[model samples]
Target: MISGLVQILLFQSLGELVSKFLLPTLPGPVIGLVLLVLWLVLRKGINPDLAMVADGFSQYLGLLFVPAAVGVVLFLPQLQANALAIISALVGSVILTIASSAFIARLLSKRESHE
Candidate 1:
């Protein structure tokens, strides 16, 4: 477990270094995740220890939203101030998402029928 955690952190740190030097725009954690994915793909399977560590982390995944909840609370006033715009965007995005998803599904169904 400890070794798995270390491996994860090592990749994250490497990603941070890459982010600092090579790609200043992309986030360090994202880069680190990509690196980790590539490594796992090349290795052809996950290490047992890493799988265990990931399972443990997954169990507490809901806890990760705490910070986001706190952030929303902290910016409550600002959010309230822009509620109109926020609501508008939310509704518009929902409509667009549904429309696009339906279109894609329809196209896929048609293609499948043809084949």
Candidate 2:
């Protein structure tokens, strides 16, 4: 368990290093996740210890939203004041996201079918 945690932290540190030194504009966590994925793909096998650690984290992923939830709660008054605009933006963004995802999936499926 300890080793698994260490491995996770190691992956995170690699991501932080890449973000800080190579791509300062990118979010460290995102970069770290990509790096971890690349590492797993390249290895072509999950390390049992790391897999256990990752599973534990995944189980509690919902808890990760606590900070954002708290922020929203704290800013409720401000959000209420601009509720209409926020609702419009949220709906518009969700629609756009779904449309783009569907379009991309269709394009990928078509390409795969042709191949």
Candidate 3:
């Protein structure tokens, strides 16, 4: 498990390095995740040990949102100041996301049923 974790971190570090040197405009970790996905797809099979380690991390995915939750708390004052704008943006985005997702799902389902 430890080794698998280490390997994941190593891949992440490589991605960070590439992003830093090649594309500083983009985020390092986002680049890292993309590289990791590419590597996994190219490999065509996951290592069981690595898979176990990943599953362990996935279990704590909810905990990953803690920092963002804290950030919202910290910025409560600012948010309150612009509550209307924030609420409008949040609602608009949510509606758009739901509509788009529903549309895509319906389209896919239709295609699948035809097949």
Estimated TM-score per prediction? 0.78, 0.84, 0.75
Q: What RMSD, rounded to one decimal, does every model reach?
A: 2.5, 1.9, 3.0
lDDT, model 2, position 60:
100
Q: What tens digits encode model 1's per-residue C-alpha lDDT throughout 10-101?
A: 89998999999999999999999999999999999999889999899999999999999999999999999999999999999999999999
Per-candidate clashes come to 0, 0, 0
How far off is residue 17 in model 3, in Å?
0.9
Higher-scoring candidate on TM-score, 2 or 3:
2
Decreasing TM-score order of the candidates? 2, 1, 3
How big is the positional error of residue 42 in model 1, measured in Å on the Cα after superposition?
0.8
Residue-level lDDT tens digits of model 2 in 30-70: 88889888988999988889889889999999999999999
Please report the candidate that would top lDDT against the real structure: 1
lDDT of 2: 0.91
Local accuracy of candidate 3 as per-residue lDDT tens digits, 49-90: 789999999999999999999999999999999999989999
**Clash pairs (backbone) in predicted model 2:** none
Clashing pairs in 3: none
